[model samples]
Target: MIGFMPMLSKELRELGSSLKILYIPIVFTLLTIMQPVTLKMLPTLLKDASNLPEGTIIQIPDPSVIDVMGSLLPKFGSLGSIIIILIIMGEIAGERASGVMAMVFAKPISYVGYFAAKLIAGSLLVIVSLFAGMIISSYYTEIMFDKVDWLDAMLGTLLYVPYILMTVAITLCCSAFMKSQVGAGGVAFVLYLVLTMVPQYLGSFFRKVSPSHLVDTASNVIMGVADTHIVAPLVGTLVLCSVFIAAGMLLLRRQEV
Candidate 1:
């Protein structure tokens, strides 16, 4: 228990030093801020592009705050997730290749403690980054559009947390097995696409099990589109994270460090 604290602190410091801590959240916030502005100006932008007859009237409904906020998940599901994967995809595998893992494990650290510390630190970083983006987004959303219900945003954010953590866990799991960080990144990205996109067309049963459902569920909450039961997807995501973490631990144990 005492040893875990330093490991966690070390991981936190590593995350703090990483540029992704700044840039990734900034990307999300920028996406949020731009959504309402883009929607409001879409008619004008389209009209200018259309080069319609002179004095042509372009009519488009102003987007609701809910719509703006709801659009966030898809942007995040696509680009934001990719950025996160790229940032963390190297974490474990890169350290291993550089002999950092070998040096650390040579000491008396518990493998479980090391793994848990990494997971906790990574999860905390994701939560903080997501919150930073959401807070900035909410401010811009309210100013550019209408005030979104804070309660709805909070609920939506809670629902979305697991999916992001799951991505980190997947990358770490892949990193543990792959000798090359680039290979880990590629495998994680491919798996991410499969998990997030493939489930859409499958069926209700797949939707219930898919982590993508968590993002969709969050969007639904933000849009006031009514809630679906999230217990399955949420639990499934948690279970999947645990499994991935365990897999990484097992792979690390087998490796000659």
Candidate 2:
């Protein structure tokens, strides 16, 4: 069995040339920059919100920068996660559709190795980009908001990896088992949206575990709370992701290629 680290490195290397990889830097920068920029502009955004007719006045609750960062963090996480999944599914199916899998198979790589590479590659790209964004955002926050609550921001930011990885894992399973790039991409995207919607519409006390709500909900845990109510949902997400990965691998192994 290939060790996960080498597999991860190999996937990261392939990511360098992929057009999809380009989105990572962009999304990362945006997520990193979003909190600072939005914090600076919230008063203005609220002012705009207040101008609306009766009952539309959103109370500009005096949210500290840390509070804003907590919310913004997840939004950024979701954006990066979705884009990665779409690209992964398309790439996997595209290779198969174009007969490029023949070239991939001709190499010494095993089916399991190839699948491992694809999943790890997708996860690494999202995690690195997410880290970059978080680091940059922290830099700006510290420089400008000297009193900003560092502990809270850090807590809010740390859960990013686990949540994003689970999301990507589910998507990779979809991509791997899919027969056509379009078929894979389309099904994955729809499933992604549906997963996202469940947490949004259905009630969940533990925000972290809710598939649809994880990214945005992740920020709640960053508020210095020792235990979040969403652990159930987060655990469910992890379980689902593992199931998807195993299923995807089974499907990939069964393919004629």
Candidate 3:
């Protein structure tokens, strides 16, 4: 626990030096803001661009706050997932490949502490970025559309965070085994797709088990739907994250570095 702080600080410093600390927020913020603004302006933009007759009208429905907020899940689930996987795929593998791990561990250090630090740091960054985007999105959504219930929106967004953490854990596990960042990224991406997308084609059982359920649960909150049973997916995600963390620690300990 004592060593976790410095290790976490090192991870944070690395993120800052790499400019991810600045740009990740920018990317997420844009993603959040883009949907509402574009939806709000779509009629005008389409009408202006179209070469239709003067009497022609572009009839577009005004999106509700729920629609606007609901759209964000898919945006984050797809692009945000990819970006995070790319950023974190190198967390441990790169260090090991570049001999940084050896140098760092030449002194007395806790392997479990190192692994915990990386997971917590990466997860923290993801949670912060996601919630920040959600907050901005909520504000914009209220202005452009109807007002969303703040408590529900906040609860839904918070519920969605474990899914992101699960992705980070998978990336860390892949990083523990792969020698290169590309390899780790590829493995993590494939696994993530399998976990989040392939389930869609399977039976209802698969839907219940997959991390994809997290999105559904969150959407229920955003849509003001009742009886969104989140316990199964939430528990599944926590278990997967724990398993991945344990696997990463085991793999890292066995590596020659």
RMSD of each: 2.0, 4.5, 1.6
Highest-scoring model, TM-score: 3
Angstrom error of the Cα, residue 120, model 2: value is 1.2
- The lDDT per prediction is 0.80, 0.67, 0.85
- Give the worst 10-residue stretch by lDDT in candidate 1: 28-37
What lDDT tens digits, residue by residue, belong to model 1 across residues 140-161?
A: 7788788888788878887899
How well is each residue in 1-257 modelled by candidate 2, as lDDT tens digits? 34445555766777876654677766777766876777777877877766566555555556565665665675565566667666577656677878887777776666777778778777767777776777677667667554556666555555556667776766677767787777776777777767666655655453445665545546766555555556565676787778777888888778766
How many steric overlaps are in each model, in order? 0, 6, 0
Candidate 2 matches the true fold with a TM-score of 0.77
Please give the ranking of all candidate structures by TM-score, highest first, separated by commas: 3, 1, 2
TM-score of each: 0.91, 0.77, 0.94
Instruction: Sort all candidates by lDDT, best to worst.
Output: 3, 1, 2
The C-alpha stretches of model 1 lying farther than 4 A from their native spots are 48-50
Give the C-alpha lDDT of model 3.
0.85
